[model samples]
Target: MTHLPPSEFTLAVRHETATLTVMIGGELDYGTSGDLLNEVSQQLTAGQPPPADVRLDFRELTYIDSSGLTALLMIHRRTSALGATLHLDNRPARLERMLHLTDVLDHLTAPPTRAGGWQPEEDDGLTEAGMT
Candidate 1:
């Protein structure tokens, strides 16, 4: 049986005036998906005002699975509930393919609607190539 190396994941957060950017590195598979969710949760409730935008920087992300996608959706929901927009930045090619194939790339990166709902924009003015 082929063996995979121990899953290595890390999150480095940068908080700005109205945005919280989390730079993620390494695999975000089942073994480490929860780390992303927990980190977001903790940051969201750390007595500071909730950010108007939550950005997940995937510049160094190496891999992801279904669980990771689920985590992204969950984070989207959480941010939307607080009237915040979710941004998936610097997505790698594989991750972009996965998000598109899973039909959640737009959902995870949508802006909040007037009714406080989440819906993909027709022209969000963002492209995978420009994300980086």
Candidate 2:
């Protein structure tokens, strides 16, 4: 069997007053997902206010496995708990599909919308119906 070379993972960060963008490249698999988490954790724990938005730029990311997806979920959870937004940016088509297929795209990019996102102040005429 032919063996493929291990994937290379690289990370870069750009920090602004209210935004932190992390650029990721290469593969994110079981072997490298932890490193991603660690890098994000370090920045979050740096004592300064957590950035209002923590964005992951996947413009150069080539691949990601389930473990990598889990890492993203973890970061999303932490950022939410800290009142920060988590954004997945510049996702390649495949990556976007991966996240969508795994049902994590919305979790990472936007807050979940409630089943009934809005309700009218007035109720429907159900009570007026004889069934009431």
Candidate 3:
């Protein structure tokens, strides 16, 4: 686990079978998204043959604004360009709702789950969360 300066986020990187798993915590707002981006960039650049998978664990993320969403999208695009897969895991309910509402959930590779281990089938459509 390594901590980066100038951000509240912490990154725990683990290598397994050509995959790089990054567990991220804290707010991924505009203020801290750059740090995360930099961390990913550094790891990819330093890898011997490029990573096969970049798994992002979002179980501890407390908040994610528009900028944060954009960052994630950017990272996904970059990883795809590098011929790597990006997987998101354990997204918070609020964030999940936001992603669905934004019509971006289909682009995510992670399975959706509710607070109580309820896994909704894909194509269930978006749920309203009182956010507009």
Estimated TM-score for each candidate: 0.80, 0.77, 0.73
- Model 1, 22-81: lDDT tens digits are 999999877677778778867766645678888999999989888788778777876786
Ranking by TM-score: 1, 2, 3
Pairs with backbone N, CA or C atoms under 3 Å apart (clashes), candidate 2: none
Best by TM-score: 1
- Model 2 stretches with alpha carbons more than 4 Å out: 1-4, 111-132
Deviation of model 1 at 56, angstroms? 0.4
Tell me the tens digit of each residue's lDDT in model 2 across 38-69.
78767766656667789999998888877788
> Model 2's lDDT to the true fold?
0.73
Per-candidate RMSD, Å = 9.2, 13.6, 12.3
> All models: lDDT?
0.77, 0.73, 0.68
Question: What lDDT does candidate 2 reach at residue 93?
Answer: 82
Pick by lDDT: which candidate is best? 1
TM-score (C-alpha) between model 1 and the true structure: 0.80
- Candidate 3 structure quality by residue, lDDT tens digits, 1-132: 986664366778888888888888988777777667667767766756777788999888887888777767766655665667778889898789889889876675533222221122222132211112
Task: Assess candidate 3 and give its TM-score to the true structure.
Answer: 0.73
